[model samples]
Target: MSSQFTVEKTQHPKTKPDQQNLGFGKHFTDHMFLMNYTAGEGWHDARIVPYAPLSLDPAAMVFHYGQAVFEGLKAYKTEGGRVLLFRPDQNLERLNISNERLSIPQIDEALVLEGIKELVRTDADWIPTAEGTSLYIRPFIIATDAALGVHPSPQYLLIVILSPVGAYYPEGLKPVKINVESEYVRAVRGGTGVAKTAGNYAASLRAQEEAEKQGYAQVLWLDGVEKKYIEEVGSMNVFFKINGEVVTPALNGSILSGVTRRSIIQILQDKEIPVVERRISIEELYEASVNGTLEEAFGTGTAAVISPIGELNWEDKQITINKGEIGQVSQELYDTLTGIQNGKVKDTFGWTFEV
Candidate 1:
């Protein structure tokens, strides 16, 4: 594990973009944290250097076999000029989970957390102050072994980059349409679905692109095995409120254990809301929609926090959720989560980490 890290400031800093239109992951901060892992030695040579394109060997295993793992979190700037992070330890812990699944070496979570704090402090100016805006943190590891093969790589490189981003969607908190994807499967039960790996996302691009072309925001994925049970959305975890109960898909080793999803469940429990994590089938969901029991639906993730689902097109049958508007539960969850994030509300859950 690397404890001490070197900081190298950039001499030619790029101009910061307009906070109003920063968009999501479009602009990066001036500096990025990088570390290396060797076969004999553990993680070492941690440094924060100028943000630039990486120069890797063309035969790097990551280019060939896609042995990469990544995690996403955020840093918020409060109105009182203070910085806060939301459930960063959970994110770092999940980083190791992905690493274990991807055959990449596990990272020291505490060390990485400290590195993240230092990196955030180094680029403090890049933290956006606009409404519903914050600094996005991306930590990733790639197999850098020059010799490519099907086996694990001997060397790896870990990088942590910061981005000044607004809301993940143009509609912001507005509910968006979701397409129920029955054609392509995201991951099987015994596959790399739970891991935050690149291939999993690459497998989703086609479905997402088609959904977007059809005027939808994203695709709600089904379980790969049955293709009838709801798994998750393309980018976020899906939740449904039906018959006065909150329901989300139970983690079946094929769905990502989302930090936001966990937080939302905890929040619901704290408020004594009936929350259930189980296998929800599309047929059951559609039946509830027809029976007028489906009350609300939303997707949770680090980038979007809470994205209400206004409409769902499954097998060419569309249903408008909560009259195509964000429901009471969705609104409350968004407000509570964002308030804690931006220091607007009291954080009783101890989720916010002040920086």
Candidate 2:
């Protein structure tokens, strides 16, 4: 059993029941977990504070230099009314990895995990019990020292906020249209793309908004150098099915190694599906599509577990995948993924951690 963190809950004076229709990141719980860290003292002053605005100096290092890292995971209220986390240790480990890349000090993994559970328990009422709904946990660290110099801060603040989120595909798991980015690059070699840092997403916002303006749901980013290999989407990892085999871009220092992506690969491999983690080029994907070998394509992440890619649109070329609908492999992957997550199936991989 995980050690429990002491919580100081602040009751929301005027709170109402959240509508089930409220989508992801809209509704928040009443209390939040926080801790402060200093270079000399290390991590200390852990507490459960009220869900309120942060007090940061105008000349804070995070404001000027963008020294921030974040993690996204979920707390699920199981059918048995028990709150659980899916591979939270993996998220904690990834968060530290991201912190190292950002020059921030590492945090205690066990303490962070314990604090998250305590926050969720305090805000248990905020966790939606409906299917496909969960409490989205956002744990982040930010440089907090009031300094104008472009150097690492001597102090940092870590926080965990909980939000009740509905299904990514509220209506259904329909296919999404993706625009192949030719001009913009999300991450380059030796860049911070592999880490879950805010700068990466901040860099991709322009392309994402442009994609939305152009009538596409998301932009599929390619390698920065050659612009031929598929890296990832704005917020999810990409996967392609070619010749009845599962293929995803390997961790090549330019793409995030998503937890969902790893889980899907493990699930498929366990079921005797040929899973390959290699560099998949855009031209090869197009060729496979034209030859009827590219059976399906999808994006995987924590928010959107598995979203099908119906069509890929590039410069003056449009390729339809799986007849512009969700394929067998995509559906199976989604079902298995969600099933294991919601406790509807046996956790063969021991992914679930009861909170």
Candidate 3:
């Protein structure tokens, strides 16, 4: 039950880069939002075209069976020009739990949140009011049948792009380092690692390009059957803080349930601050960093909403946390979740959604 949509606008409009060097997802946003799906006529034509290039049919079953599913959210503007959207209905209920773990069909989370509020109100001037900048939405799905050996994929598409960003780790809040890998792994218990598919990040790009050639800014995944618990950190969702509480890692079906990791565990349980999920061991976070309580370490999603894990290399041993600094509860949970996502904090947990 979803139809009505169209908007063509954009007779070429490019030049928009330099919100003090945007970074993160390079650039993009001139209008985009598509929708198709065809198995006895289901999700029809919806459009908002003009952001080009996407011919797909080189035997497109997501280019040979990797079905695909995606999501990531953001779009804050509010210096008064209003454009909020932080919990986009929890990213379309986690993209239909990654399209039912990649079998791929189902998606109408209220017609994709009204096609993400009319494509962010028709690209609301491409968002970005500087400060830390944002407007990176994404939302994807693909499995376009066009002949492939894959068993599913009757045909599908679903786009939704827009990008305009900054700091998805070039060390914006500093503190990163990580690398506790212990020989790859990342996802077990019936796999597809809690489903944000696309071959679970194409199987972690050869251990994040060998932990970025030894400089380390990613790779903390452990537990594809006891590589000794831990789970994720580079693609976000880690968190430590031992003794004074706050621990994370317990959505086990192999992690990846992060809408900024449940809004940093509901803002550390609404500031009572004892947050605890369960099972977290790299020898219990290196014995709480050798009995100093381990203090603070962080990582959450929607692209670095709170990175902060200042050093931890393992197996050859190295540690450092809080002293490598960024704590104070990861700068007050990134200033109260970027101040309740750019409205300068006062959504009172309704979790924003203006557009």
Candidate 4:
């Protein structure tokens, strides 16, 4: 792995958008980081080039076999004029986990991190300093072998693009309604459930569409084997505060180990709050709601950070959590996590990496 990167500035720079109206992932930065991998030659040709469309053969393996993986993180501009990245190492490590699962070549984590830092530094002006805006970083890899085969491609392209995105939800921290999906299963154990591959999200589209039709923000998935145990939410990990304890479904090889989820758990434990990870069943959750013990429910991930789940619609039996408002725990966690990311609060865990 080489530490050198060729730089190419865009000849025609586009006008920057208003930070106030920057929606999620709608606008891209001027440049992107790119690299290539060959089966025998390893990863090479690392460079920072102008953002542009890719030209791939019609028979590209990624188009046919779906041998692709991606990871998302964000870079924040602090109030004091410092730029920070939140736990990028964890995301890259998870990317390699996905690569191993998909039979793709392992990436040089340190080298990739360097590339990301350089790219972010180059595009530092694009980092929005608005109330809830930051530069979203998307790193992805796709099989590029131009063959109609159902196997891993011998060649791969790795790219990292930046987007100045606003709050993932239009309502900000306001609670959202989620549908408990029963008809569709997102992933199964021993499958590609845990891996952050393209297929998992593709498999979730139908259920998500139906949930949207029902006026829900996202769908809560259940275990595929029995369809009784709680799995995760559409794009985040689900958590519940029942009775006096905080509980999230255990990572049973079918749920993504979200970076925000881990940070929340750590923050809870640091505060001496009771937090547990185990196999939580939907029936148990519903029973808790019946007994009036189900207090707060939220989803944690990179995009939304902490999405307060206000209502759970299970087979038309809607249960409003925390009176359909944000709970104390959810609010505190969101504030603390976002504070650390933006350098407003002390990062006791040393999670943020300064660029």
Candidate 5:
């Protein structure tokens, strides 16, 4: 795993964006890290080069077979001039899981982590300093084989890029309206849903677009088989506070295992709050709303630490959560998570990795 990395600085550096209006994934830093994987050579030629368009063969396997995987995390610049990463190890572990599922060669976890740290340090100035702003890190692998056969690619390319991003949603922490999607299913049991691959997201674009058209922020996906049980939100894991108990869907191989979701569960358990991970049906959620037991709802992910779900529209029926405002539980969780990330509060869970 010990490999020498060559660094090449960009000749024409771009101007940094305004921190206040730094939208997500719109702009990338000057340099990116890349490594290649071949059948017998394994992974080699690790280097940091100027960010630019990639020249790939048109017959690359990724275009046809969709053998690719990616992971998203962030680097934060604290008020005290310190840089930090939140639960990066977990993200890499999950990336390997995705690689295994996609039949892509496994990455050296430690080496890749070192590459990420080096890349972040190399572009330290790119980390945003404004409130709710951070450097979004995207690490991905793609099959680069030229042949069109339906087998695993013998070649691959791993790339890590950095983007200075603002809030994931333009509304920031404001509560959002979600539409329960019953028509199109995102994933099914024994499928690629659990993997953070391109195909899974490609399958969701239609549903997400329809949800957006209906004046909703995101789609609340249901299980594919029954279309009755709740799975996850379009881009995050969902949680509902029902009758003082917080419930989220159990990991049943069809939902992405989110790092933020795991952290929130741990945080709740540490505080001794009633948290349960089990299958919850959409009908049960609607019934809880009718009985006035659905206290609050929120979605957890890396992009939006916690997105408070204020309203849900399901089959022409609308249910308002917490009077269409941010609830106390959601607020506390958001504050604690963001505070730990930005160095405003003590990180008791040892989740922050200081770079």
Candidate 6:
């Protein structure tokens, strides 16, 4: 919400080795963007300060209540060296939705765009020109008011940080095995699951660790009440191919409405694929898999645009999908999505925002 910003320049004094193969969210850029928000003053004191530690009170509300929300996106450099952003407006809109749900004051769309542009332009050189690498941008707001109560904090801090990230899967897109957890739930009805808040991810750590120990890439979270309907997988939204239709879980107040998921649905519908957005039960998926109706399964998100789900391990049963490889439709979807993102194909939907 802060419109006034004092621009400053800083540098990363020490550099690491040529770690070209570094995975996502590992390295940081030179500077960061920060802005403060108070109850009566709204947002103010915006600055592009050095990327360093934050001085917070021991009794900060965020430390106790976890009143924080964040969004993730990327800045890509095109073939002609023209940097661009894919559907940044969509990300900004989603950030506001997250903020409102978390009791934080909504940010002005224009200011948010300007702040993002300023940060990306300041760190433009950090945008990796390599094939699967780009500048990963993380914008977040946290409750900073020194309060011990279990309520929303009146003061908050909004900041954006950049990171040079390699391809999510450096070895090319590979199918991942997922384990469905029937014990723990990622989201519940009327909860903060839809918001990109810190608590949701924190609650998923135990399940993720358990999945990893079981030789699964991520946990396929089911609905909280019944634990029968499919919600999402890890942090990504899940998709399924049943019969000849491409279907995903309907945005029913529990799962995150990912920008990548919306883009894929639009592309599918544009190409005349029978794309359906509805509640999909785990039993239906298992039945479809057994009857050869479920052809493929995958997850969609910003980090990995579309990741194939090779196998779904539930209970003691293992169901292999698309023969442990990327399916026909999944490959096409990935190609079209990434092509539009990298400026290789025509962006009919006007999703690419050239910088």
Clashing residue pairs in all predictions, respectively, total 0, 0, 0, 0, 0, 0
- Which candidate number maximizes lDDT? 4
- Candidates' TM-scores? 0.98, 0.97, 0.38, 0.98, 0.98, 0.97
Candidate 3, pairs of clashing residues: none
Clashing pairs in 2: none
**lDDT ranking from best candidate downward:** 4, 5, 1, 2, 6, 3
Residue-pair clash count for candidate 1: 0
Model 1 / residue 31 / CA error / Å: 0.3
What is the Cα-based TM-score of model 2?
Answer: 0.97
Q: Please report, as a residue range, the 10-residue window in candidate 5 with the lowest summed lDDT.
A: 1-10
Q: Candidate 6 residues 1-355, lDDT tens each?
A: 2345677777444374254775788888778989899889898887887788999999998889999999998888888888788888988898899999999999887787778888788778788877877788899999998979888899999999988888888888899999999999998979998899999999999999999998999999999999999999999999999999999999998999999999999999999999999999888988888998989999999999899999999888888898899998998999998888887778899998876
lDDT of candidate 4 over 1-355, digit per residue (tens): 2348988988988899998889989999999999999989999999999999999999999988999999999999999999999999999999999999999999999999999999999899999998878899999999999999687789999999999999776567999999999999999999999899999999999999999997999999999999999999988999999998999999999999999999999999999999999999988999999999999999998888999999999996888899999999999999999999999999999899999
CA lDDT of each candidate?
0.93, 0.89, 0.85, 0.94, 0.93, 0.88
lDDT of 2 by residue, 89-175 (tens): 999999999999999999999999988888887888888887788889999999999988888899999999988899899888999
Off by over 4 Å in 3: 1-32, 35-46, 49-66, 77-79, 84-118, 123-138, 146-148, 151-156, 161-221, 233-236, 239-281, 284-286, 297-299, 303-327, 331-333, 340-355
For candidate 1, the lDDT comes to 0.93
- As for model 5, its CA RMSD to the true structure in angstroms is 1.4
Model 6 CA lDDT for position 154: 90
| Location of the lowest summed lDDT over 10 successive residues in candidate 6 | 10-19
Clashing pairs in 5: none
Q: Residue 218 CA error for candidate 5 (Å)?
A: 0.8
Instruction: Give the C-alpha miss distance for residue 125 in model 1, angstroms.
Output: 0.9
